[model samples]
Target: MRIRDTGDLWWKNAVIYCLDVETFMDWDDDGIGDFGGLVQRIDHLADLGVTCLWLMPFYPTADLDDGYDIKDFLGVDPRLGDVSDFVELIRTARDRGIRVIADLVVNHTSDQHPWFKAARRSKDSPYRDFYVWRADEPPPTHDEVMFPDEEQGIWTYDEQAGEWYRHRFYRHQPDLNTANPQVRDAIAKSIGYWMQLGLSGFRVDAVPYFVSGTADDHADGLDDPHDLLRELRGFLGRRRGDAILMGEVNVPYEEQRRYFGVETRTGDEDDVQGPVGQELTLQLDFNAMQYLFLSLARQDVAPLVDTLRARPAIPRDTQWATFLRSHDELTLDRLTDEERQEIFAAFGPEPHMQIFDRGLRRRLPPMLDGDPRRLRNAYSLLFALPGTPVLFYGEEIGMGENLDVPGRLSVRTPMQWTAERNAGFSRAQPRRLVAPPPDGGYAPEHVNVADQRRDPDSMYTFMQMLIRRYRECPELGWGEVEILEQPEPSVLAMRSTWQDASMVTLHNIGPEATTVTLELDDIPADTRLVDLLQNGEQVIGKDGKVEVTLDSYGYRWLRISRPESRRLL
Candidate 1:
């Protein structure tokens, strides 16, 4: 039993909710969501039990790449309101105990950015080196192009600069030269500026591309990239002791661990104080998410269990950020072709439903065929997993995607607050919206917060229940996780224990109802498994064995209890 309720580790038991302001709500009826709209909707998030709000980029942009191609890192887009509106949003969100974090997209900048504009003017410009450039014509690195349909290679020739610049993403956005001390300082300044303006932290975008150097970069750029992360972490700590940097690093588990800060030994190898993570505080768990999909496709728990066991241990303070769908596509690049095919066949059977040849552009509701039981079961499993659960906007209401929207924008449609015109997202005409609200059975008419709020059995209500249960059971986030042994392959039974508190969660992903047997040898002679979801309780007799029946796609959270057990003050 261990107690870990310290001030610096709030993220250990926090629930993160991600949203894009452009599509979240349009308060001014200008066909775009603004900070004013977000401020008005703070109560909705508070009601949903979100501890942290991970906001997508709202900085001044060229309107390319869905705000990722940032033109000014410090200025707010006029259409989305000014600095005053942003400050008001932060103040309002904080009033509800919801900390806000915005996107730190330093990996690249829009070509229209002032720095990029000046850099292209002359070779002697100081900003010229701020971006990666090669004077000589580089060979075709066709494989490096991120968007195969749009880009032919990673290097795009700049006519004004007479040099080829590198862009790992799109041609309109050029990768920054992080190796340059001045650029690093600029990025740090931007981070500090936002923190001073009330941002709790940042969701670092494209962390790998931001830190790693490429062949076209300067000679010194190839040096250890992790050093930048260490510096950023140190800077963040000095500014705000509790501020966190949640990076988007999509790579293999072995490689991804390095982003959390590698363990280094001092002069004495046997020192009592071991090395700890000194870099990013949290990272998106791409590995477990991919395996989760695989497990769902097979309707077996083996894949998820294997991946969970394979996860490398990180420093106690550092944690994983888990999610089902994000603002972007649901990527499955880590999985093999055969496994990827299985998931595609199960969730994304249509060609239009897939993207990047490695991911799905659709949201979860349509993928699961809008089955209420399975939806609740999967979400329950997500909240029960050993990490901080992150929900994309409208996930609580089970929003669907619009296939008519090209590329990743399919999942970036407007939020449906009601069944009114334009889903009540805006007063403007439907055609003038940022993106049309999804159509079909999953449209606002059928699925919306207004309707769900009235129905007790709706997805929105179920998510609220799941979130309440997750927040109540801190063990799920800060406990020792164990994959309990069970006979049914379709069922996954796991236990999380922290201090004197213990909880066991079981989920059945298959279509058929089944019974699962569990042996709790360490339990007391006359103990009971208290159902946290309801009033029912199951007694574990002297034999230390318990049998529980589960309906198809059913789930349960049970707490180990003894007759003498009592709550502590």
Candidate 2:
């Protein structure tokens, strides 16, 4: 069955931009960003050429976990404007040919949520089964707590319920029991309700934790936990044929494949059947992201090349979401201790710049020391990767993180729009702003949207160019990646070929300019290499080799142009 009735899976080539309502823009001047302010900035996103806007939970929350501790799944936080404002934002974004997807935080809920509050009230309460609970003194298990810096254990004793409840992340946010049919139905209803309100899809939070049910909580009917994903996928397909479910499952490649669904076989083991995408439409490539930072840290592209080549092949409809920096910390937990320290030494040398002993609480600009060449090269590689690219809110303008803020919030500062008060995010006082903008070199005065928009060579304009070129080259998004062999260890060379179209991209991650000759087999001699970033083309020699020169930390996106072929998109 076709996943999308449109015949075009938009996500395969979509550019996703993620932002938080409380930090994006403040229209009410209450020091907090709202939908009203977001609406005013929809044009900015359109101008940036993003196809998908991933909204970080604007739901009514207790405001403890950066909106992830959802108090009400169906209602928008009054602070961020009412339901009407949300609908208007969706409408405006849609009018600009952009699809909106919300953060689905059903893995857990705020302890203050009505259901959780009711569950804690009595032992036999109807909502008691809404959460995972253990009656006796919970024995110590080897289940590692998510936040070792704060929480010491995953199970927290609840005095009200007279039992120990499990929480994968934080104590204030309790995990919901998916094993319960009613709870599963409630989750499905929430998805349907949001889709009815015009959301294209969801960025499902903590998918592994959401599906990993406890042994004691097992039930009949849904024997395998993955069946729940199949159920949700089927429901989404029926409700909206093109809607997607992007999951945040940061597991090993093999384990990650399970979340994408298994190969369906009707006959014997030898008689294998075709594969089916019964689960998530897309997943974040945490492994590749880690290797990317490692490559940047060491100024060597071997790690990244290895990681990309190691990725497991999945079903056609499913894809990977590539990102450099996200809303959370730049997690390096997937890497080895030695590799993690190598990144920390290069990027997060100071202790304050590190977080949770596993990741760096910084953005790419600051990590790269605000070097424009390096930043441009990094973003170039991001778009050239073999997946849909995702950009954090402030990435386009080269925003830096405020290490003063504690933990991951360091990177979750307000958007810098201008050099004026509150960085043009709001009219409120500096103290009242949602989160203070970065100070010093990377402050709003030095780096902002207004200033960058005016500068022709600004990072914002560079990002716009990259987005434009990326949209033009569909091969980069929907093609087989072939890592081209080159001499320079600091240069990453690769080719992406989709059908009749082919493109070759090269990145010099080092600080010195160099030239590399690549052997392009199968292509006819004297073929022209059409440069996508610049206004020139190089002809391939008769030996099927081409010499390309690059500046320090430079990149090139060249489309193979054969004689008499007139496609120049």
Q: What is the alpha-carbon lDDT of model 2 when measured against the actual structure?
A: 0.89
State TM-scores per candidate.
0.96, 0.96
lDDT for 110 (candidate 2): 97
Clashes of each: 0, 0
Looking at model 1, which ten-residue stretch has the lowest summed lDDT? 266-275
Q: Report the lDDT tens digits of candidate 2 across residue range 272-303.
A: 23436789999999999999999989999999
Off by over 4 Å in 2: 1-7, 141-143, 211-217, 221-223, 264-275
- Model 1, 402-423: lDDT tens per residue? 9999999999999899999988
Residue 270 displacement (Å), model 1: 13
